[model samples]
Structure formats: C-alpha cells, structure tokens
Target: MVATFGEVVYESSRAFADDEEEECEAQTGLSFEVEHTSVAKSLLEKGSPAAGLVFCAFVGKVAVGFGDGFVNNKSGFDLLAEVCMVGQGENVVDIYLNRPKKKVVAQLYYGAKDKNNPVIFALFNTHGVPRFLANEIVSKVTEFIEVSNRILIFHSDTLAYYQSDERCEGKVFYVASSKYSRANIPSTAVPLAPPNVIGGIGAGVLMHGEMMDKPALLLANYGENELVDSISLQPFAAIVKQGAPDPSSFSLSQIFKQLELTISQSLKSNVNPVAISNLYI
Candidate 1:
C-alpha cells in the first residue's frame, strides 16, 4: 500500500528483529504498537498525501518513483534508486575528473591525451543522470589532459611557476578555489591568491581548463574524505571523450552510465536482487 516517510520508516522499523528494534526506535522514533498492529497497518496502507508532495524540491520537478526504494536490477531499473537522491545539500561537491578511454602508457600522442591527467570531461546519455556516471567521465577527461601537457604533475594540492619576460619576472601559482566553474575559469587570473583551499563545486569544473588558477581541486565538506578517495579510483578515471549529444550539452547521462557500470562492478561478482532486497527489508 502507500506510506508516509515517517510511516514507511516506522513499518520498516517494526519489521526488524528484537535487538535492532530499539536502535530504529531511537533513530527514527518508531516504536512497537502501544495500540495495536491493525491501527498501524491502516495508517501505513493509507499514507499521507504529504509524502507525494515531497518532490525533487530543488528544480521543483516531481521526483521519479512512488517514494518506494525498490529496483529490478535490470537495465532501466537503476533509476529506481532515486529515492536516496532526496534532500541532498549542495555542500558536497561531487567531482568527476575523467581520463581518456584507450590510453597509452606515459606517452602523449598528437590527439590522444593522457588518461591519467586530471581533466573535466562530460559524457552524454539518453537516460537521466545518476551518481555512478561520474566514474566514466572522469576516466576519459584524465586521458585528454595528459596528452596536452608536457610536464605532467599531480598533487592533492596546488603548484606554481615563475614567468620571466623581457620586462619583469612574475610568480604564478596554480591556485585552487571552489569559487570558479569550467565556463568561467578561462577568465580567472593566474597564481591564485591566498587563503582559499581549492575544493568544492567550481574546483571540479576548473580541471578542464589548460592552466587553472590552481590545479584541479575539489573542496569537500568536512569528514568526507571518502569522496576524494572514491574519485581517485581506476574506473572513475576512465573518461568518455564524446557521447550522444544532449539538449543541455551536459552529457550527464553518459557520465551516469559510466558511474553505474563502475558501481555495479564494485558490488560483488554475483549479487542476488532478492537477497539484496531482503537485506534492505
């Protein structure tokens, strides 16, 4: 039947065994029937309309799915996970620094970029985008950037250089900042001036540029270094150079496809959908 977020959580909680009961109760405020099972069942069967009202929120688009978290584990079934996408804040910057597909080892070909070099790339997909897409795009972009640069250096932080012309010598540091986007980074001045650690939304976008105010940096929220580590993995570096054109030109769908592949690969070789669903239940 239908269920509100709270009611859904409450029913899910009641379904758990004894030891787990208190934990869910404490966390979700879902307790056993002080009244009766039938009363709770009735409420769960007819959930509030408020749950349906909780759309995507930001873009105001109605969220996909019926507020239920279930998937068939098939081709298009991945879209069902959208329930977890709810209520995410912009505080976390999801970076996809992709490297090129079919990369050569330590050699920069004319058009073949280094798949390892950090570069922002976008992949297009016909389906809507998801978190998993980031992995593929990151791989492709990395390859393209490596081919373009002669001295390839990578660090978790920024680097600098001094430029001496006939007139004078000026120090230029590749400063990283969360304030800039790929579109606007071209206009940014070199030797990024102080106090800002390159990490965040703009930092991921900046990686695509020839010379960044700082090396590609991603400003992440505190206690989330795992996000940084996750992007560093191999699959995330496999960049998708080009994909089918998108109306918005974002190619987010391609990125999502790659991400899904990478994630599916990570979950054990054999995963039973029914068993997995049972775990969630």
Candidate 2:
C-alpha cells in the first residue's frame, strides 16, 4: 500500500519570449506508481457527464473548493478529505463514482449544475496535490472521466519571471502542448518566458497531451501566497465564461463570489471540506 510522490521542494518558473518549453527546477519532487487497471471502470460502466472538454482548475490558495462533500460512502472504508498530507506509505484515496456525485476522490462531485446547462464539467484542485502524492493523484484521476482531444488547465503559482508584478497581481500566461492548442489560446494571456517552467500536476497533464498529440492548454495565473480571495482570479472565469455556450448567461461575478465564499469559509471558519476528499484529509 506504499506510494511514491514528487514532493516539489523548490519550484521556479523561468521567463521566455517565444513559444518554447518551460524550464523548471525543483529541488525535491514526488513520484509514485500504482496499479489502476480498473480506475475508469466506474465512468465506463455508469456513464459520464456530457462536456466538450474538462475545465479543470488548480488554485494554490483555496484549500476548500466546489468539489468538496462528494463522499465515496463505502460503508467500512474511511471517507477521505480533499486536503491532507501524504507521506510515502499505503494510503486510501477516492477518484470516481456515479455522475451526479463524482467530482474526484479527494472531491468527486456529481449533479453539479445537474440541470441542463452550458456544461462546464469543472474540476477544482485545492492546491499542491503533488506535494502530498506528487502527480500520482492527478494521473490516477485522469483515468476516471474521459474527454475530447482538447483540455484546459487553469492554475495559480509563483512565476519568478513575473516577480516584478508579483504573484497576486502577476499577469496570466499560457503554455500550449501543440501549435493547434496555441492557436486556441486567448489573446489576453501572455506567453511564459523561454527559460521559465510550469510545474505540478498541470505540467504532467500538458506533457502527456503533447506526446499523445492532444491539444491542451495550461494557463498560469501567478500568485504570491495561498489563495484567500478571488482578486486576480477573474482571468480564469473570463476564459471559461467566454467559451460557454451563451457567454452572457454566465455571470463572472457569481463564480467569483462563490470562490470568495469558499476561501472565506476555509480561513474564517477553519473548515476545509477539501480535507475529506482523503489524500489531503
């Protein structure tokens, strides 16, 4: 039951002028392997939600996310929190389930926006999932739901290249896996520096997409501290809202307010439902 993880001790984002691969330097990282032959079996057997692609987000500061509270409820099995510290040992985690309740193992949610809506099919990561389990959690979770060739990953982290503006006010940048993905990137985002690198779970997803020839976009919103509010989070909402079936129907502020509340509850109330998702629990 032991696991390996790439605990990222030191992460630096290098700057680049053109569209080159990111240059990452991590003092320590988490790495692990698991047997997941039946990982996606539930989604395959039970069916998955409808969506063009997954709009997954990784916000470093928001420990509590919209994905919280979706439990596995396996009778004797202990329910997991979305946020928890993981060491190199046998650990039980959640991943998939019925559509109305599946968000993820740490936070698998279903029936989210169950009504016939624009179909965001969103996935939220509290932050630094890899620090506890490296990208193993992400890699395993990807086995759950299926998506099209295109994937969009939104995350907040420190970008040394943008140290001038700072992570809180730092500009948004994007790194695409292929030329096609780059063309799809919105004009509002800047390109990460040539020598800079994008790390964490998003890095693994993007690289895998590149090798598979799948078009994927990794949008970075630089930030200095753990997320507390939705100050500079608008760009993520903007990109997502812009892609909705009816852009106007999607209220940017509403999502922000939700984000604000989630952060508020985590800080003020000291309750991170994210911890229940197990790995982080």
For this target, which candidate reaches the highest TM-score against the unseen true structure?
2
lDDT by residue for model 1 (1-281), tens: 22211111112211112443242232321111111133222211222111110000000001111112323321111121121221112211122212222211111111013222212221111112222322233233332222221211122211100011121111111222222222222222122233122222111212222233433222221111111123212222333122112222323334435534544554565521111221110
User: What is candidate 2's lDDT per residue for 1-281, written digit by digit as tens?
Assistant: 11112121223222221222122223243232222223222222222222233344442223233323324321111111212121112222234322222233333222222222222222334232223232333344443332322333333332221222222221222322111232243222222222133322222223323333433223222222222223223333444444432322333335444554554465466543222111110
Candidate 1: 10-residue stretch with minimal lDDT? 52-61
- Report the error of model 1 at residue 59, Å: 24
TM-score of 1: 0.19
How well does candidate 2 match the true structure in TM-score terms? 0.31
The superposed Cα distance between candidate 1 and the true structure at residue 70, in angstroms, equals 37
- Reference-based lDDT, residue 173, model 2: 23
Candidate 1 local Cα displacement, residue 152, angstroms: 21
Name the 10 consecutive residues with the lowest summed lDDT in model 2: 74-83
